[model samples]
Every structure is written in C-alpha cells, then in structure tokens.
Target: MSGSLRHGSGPRSLSEIARSGGPTGSGSFVYDEATLRSLISKWVALADHYDGSMRRINLGAVEPPGLDFASEALSKSANTSGTAYLKYLEQNYRYCVEQAQLLQDTLDDYLGVEHQNVTELNKTDQPTGSQSGI
Candidate 1:
C-alpha cells in the first residue's frame, strides 16, 4: 500500500468498539480480528507441519545384529546400542512434540478467548431495544 496506516477486516460490529473511533479508541487492545486469525493459521500450520515431520522419522526401526557373527558379545553389544538409540529417539520425539503442541495450544486458546470476548462485548454493548414504546 502507501505510507499510511491500514486496518484489517476487524470485528463485524464496529459501533460498539469504536466508542471513540479516534486515536486510542475503546481500550488498550484495539482488537484486530484479521491479525489474530492470521496468527492462528500460522500456528496451526506449524503444528501440522511439525506433526508430519516428527512422525516420519522412523527412528524405532533398529537394524538387527549380524546373524552370521553368532557371538554372545556381539549380540549383547547390539542389544545395548539398540535400546539406547531407541530410548533417545523416543524421548527427543516426545519432548519436541510437547513443546510444539504447547505453543500451538496457547495460540489456539488465545484466538478462541479473544473472539469470544469481542463477541460478548459486542452483544452487551448493543442497544437492547427501544424502551420508548414501554
């Protein structure tokens, strides 16, 4: 665009929020609905991307020991290495997913909460009806 301030699609009901409609209107939070949606989209996509990537790593498939070797020491060594690698992969996978999920969940929750708060605020601020007839 140009060197001017641009606003997003914003809340459907603007009258309730634009009490001032000037610099520093309503409250601290200007409430940009579009920006919130964009952030949520990114967060969800990241979560999905991570989900796809992390599971694709087939770390659980360990190679069997050399059958031709036929030595107890070799078998024991293979078992130990296999267990260690498996455990490492499992722990790291869990940890990475947990962190990604935490971020995704937090963003999702904020989006829900902000949307709900705006909707409720709009409902409450709206003119109930004309009391003139009563």
Candidate 2:
C-alpha cells in the first residue's frame, strides 16, 4: 500500500488511485494497506508473545519463606497482585489481537473493492468486435 488515499480530499483520478493501490476511507483519515498490515502483524506478534509469557508464569507456585502470620499475609498479597497483573496482561493481549483482526478485515475489504474497480475498468477498456464480423 501507498499513501494519499482519502475519502473527501479535494479530487482524485482513478488512474491515480489505481497506481497508489492504497486504503479506503470513510470521511477524513485514510490508511495505507501495506502499512496497516505491518502494524497489524506487530500487534499480533506482541499479543502472542504476551500470551506465551503469561502462560509460562506460575504465580501459584510461589511460597512464603515462613509459616508465620506475616508470611501468610504476604503470600495473600502476592497472590492478589499476581492475579491483577495477569488480568491486565490478558486484557492487553485481547486488545492487541482484536485490533489486528479489525485492521485485517479493513484491508481485506479495501482489496476487494480495488479488485472490483480494476475488473470493471478492464471490462470497459476491452475492444468489442463488431456484429458485421469485419
């Protein structure tokens, strides 16, 4: 994908758009498909890394140094903190994966429209033979 694909920017020709092979926009912002895909890949990678890291962590395996009340309190606090931290990581992973999926869907749609436009243009540009068979 290339830059300069806009929704209501002043004016654009089909050839210019076809040459760019860029994004589809709604009103103001337009994203380049290639750039978008790269970002999406990063997001997915980040999410997967986070998920794998979280899976490797075993907060429950941690034990207190002593069997005293203070140790028990510390253990409970650690568990609470660990659970909260894991929750945060889970949310972050979900957000990253979700954003990647959304961007991927948008790119797919843009590609579909671009393909259709090219197909239509080719149909119109084709040379039709005359009925006279000359």
Candidate 3:
C-alpha cells in the first residue's frame, strides 16, 4: 500500500513506535518496588510547598515572587500569556502531581497530534520504498 503505516512486521512510524511501549516507552516502567515506593512517598509529601504558598498568598504580605507587577484589575483584564510559575502550577493541579497514570494519559494526548502529523505526511508524500524489520 502506498501510504501503509505498517512496513512488513515492524513499527512503521514514530506513532507506532510509541504505541508499542517499552521499559521507558509507556506501560513497561521497570522500577523496583522499593524505588516506586520511595518515589510515590516523595510525591505524596510534595504538598509542603503548597502550604507555604497558601500562607504567602493569604497574608498578602507580597505578590508571590516572579509574578509581574500589575493591579488585579489590569492583570485580569489583559488575559496575558505567560503568567507566574506558581500560578500556572496552581491552575494545572492534576498535571503537577507525579504518578504513573499521568504518563499514559500524557502520551496518548500527544500521540493524537503525532498520528495526525503522520497522516498529513503520508497524504503529501506516501513512501513507495518498502521498509524491512520484525
């Protein structure tokens, strides 16, 4: 087939390669129980920073560091791109957490875009050459 994604029996594109999964790819995360436990424990205890930031924001003692100086009305009105890191982190709470579930979710999200790109490329210039592998 002119635009065939599968070349013989092997992964024919980056999308396929990623979907295949491996030790570092997706499902095949090969960490020992102790390592995974240590990581998860560290991840679970990550909220101390949140406590500090909340205290700072609550006190209104100072604008949380790195946030550009602007009045609330102006900052709100502008709808600026590139807000402070803390603010961005606060907004994306789900992504901020370190967990195995997020890995596949994130990969699937980007894989859609990659698949689209591969489709577009195939449409423009479908390879005639046969690829070889198992």
In model 2, the runs with Cα more than 4 Å from the true position are: 1-27, 113-134
- Ten-residue segment with the worst summed lDDT in candidate 3? 113-122
How would you order the candidates by TM-score, starting with the best? Answer: 2, 1, 3
Query: Which candidate has the highest lDDT of all?
Result: 2
Q: Model 2: what TM-score?
A: 0.60
Q: lDDT tens digits, residues 1-134, model 1?
A: 79976676344333233333323535444435455444434443444444455566554344545656565556667677766766665565455444434433443454544323322322354344431100
TM-score of each: 0.36, 0.60, 0.32
Compose the digit string of candidate 2's lDDT tens values, residues 1-134.
Answer: 37865556643533244335533455444467677656665676677667777998976445787999999888888988888888888899888766666565556665764322322322354336321100
In order, the Cα lDDT scores of the candidates are: 0.45, 0.60, 0.39
lDDT of 1 at 41: 42
Q: Where in model 3 is the C-alpha error above 4 Å?
A: 1-29, 59-86, 98-134
True lDDT of residue 79, candidate 2: 86
Report how far residue 113 has shifted in candidate 3, in Å. Answer: 34
Query: After best superposition, candidate 2 residue 113: deviation in angstroms?
Result: 8.7
